[model samples]
Target: MTAVVALLRAVNVGSRTVRSAELKAVATSLGHTEVVTYVNSGNLVLVPADGASPDDVAAGLSAAFESQYGFAVPVVARTAAEWELVVRALPFRAEAESDRSHLVVYCWDGVPDVASIRTFDASVYGNETVIWHGRETYAYYPDGIGRSKLTLPVLSKAAGRVGTARNWRTVLALQKLAQERS
Candidate 1:
């Protein structure tokens, strides 16, 4: 079996109404064992049956969700090692006194865009900043993410892709969980 982390987008937001337990149940039925969900934001770790590609795992989970909930759902899957790389690639460290609000969004299957991400720098928002391109992003908002332009909804419009966002804490949790499973 291969360990994987599935980052689901837009669950438990508004009326979509997917509980973490339901996500775990659906994941188990889709052939993932040792299923565990972190919080209600769709951070999950599991081991897929042998010979299953990440794409296979994703497609099976998507179909299962549609069949069980009667609505189409999209999922992104990453290997435990891949996730570890993403976490390690953080552009900024926590040593900065101003980086307390820093956040990173997890993503999959996209190229990191150099042009767009470089267009905005730390000076744009005084203390807040947003750097996004393909499957990973680093954001710093002194005020908060809610009032920041670096939000996923805004970045998605420019990046032209649908993806999931997780703060640094969530990323660490997933990395830790994946490490434990491995």
Candidate 2:
């Protein structure tokens, strides 16, 4: 069995609301064990059933979620090892420890278009930085995310693909949860 983390996009946001309980139930029904949800924003850590790839788990959860909830939910899946890689690749570890809510890691379903990341001007934003590492993007907003120009929509457009982000605290919590399961 492989531990997987599923980061769902656009859940419990705006007009789309999904309960954590329902999400856990869906995972259980799909044969994923040791299922655990971090928050209402659709962060789940579980062990995938035998022989299921991360893509398969992502697609299955997405389809099942939409079929049950009447709305499309894009799921980004990563294996436990991959998640550990992302966690270790965090560029702003100090900021994550100081102001966790301001530090976010955005994980893409696949390699994002490099154009946006490559062409970005870090100098344009004061006290903010966006770094692209592997399939994940690390963003730190020292002035707080609400006041920063690098909002979720902007990052989403820059990546040119659907992805999900979790705050530093949530990321650490998920890692701990997955560790317990493993």
* Candidate number with greatest TM-score: 2
Residue pairs with backbone overlap in model 1 = none
lDDT of each: 0.72, 0.86
Evaluate residue 136 in candidate 2 and report its C-alpha lDDT on the 0 to 100 scale.
Answer: 88
The lDDT, on a scale of 0 to 1, for candidate 1 is 0.72
Residue-level error in angstroms, candidate 1, position 110: 2.0
* lDDT string, candidate 2, 67-180, tens digits: 998999999998888888889998997887778888989888888788877887755766788898878889888888777777767777778878888888888888888777
Across 1-182, the per-residue lDDT of candidate 1 in tens digits comes to: 55788887776777777888999998887768888899987777888866577677777877887788777677778888888887777776762335444566647446555565556455654566655544776666667667665566666554556667778778888989988877
Candidate 1 differs from the real structure by a C-alpha RMSD in angstroms, to one decimal, of: 2.8
Q: TM-scores of all models? A: 0.84, 0.93
Give the top-scoring candidate (lDDT). 2
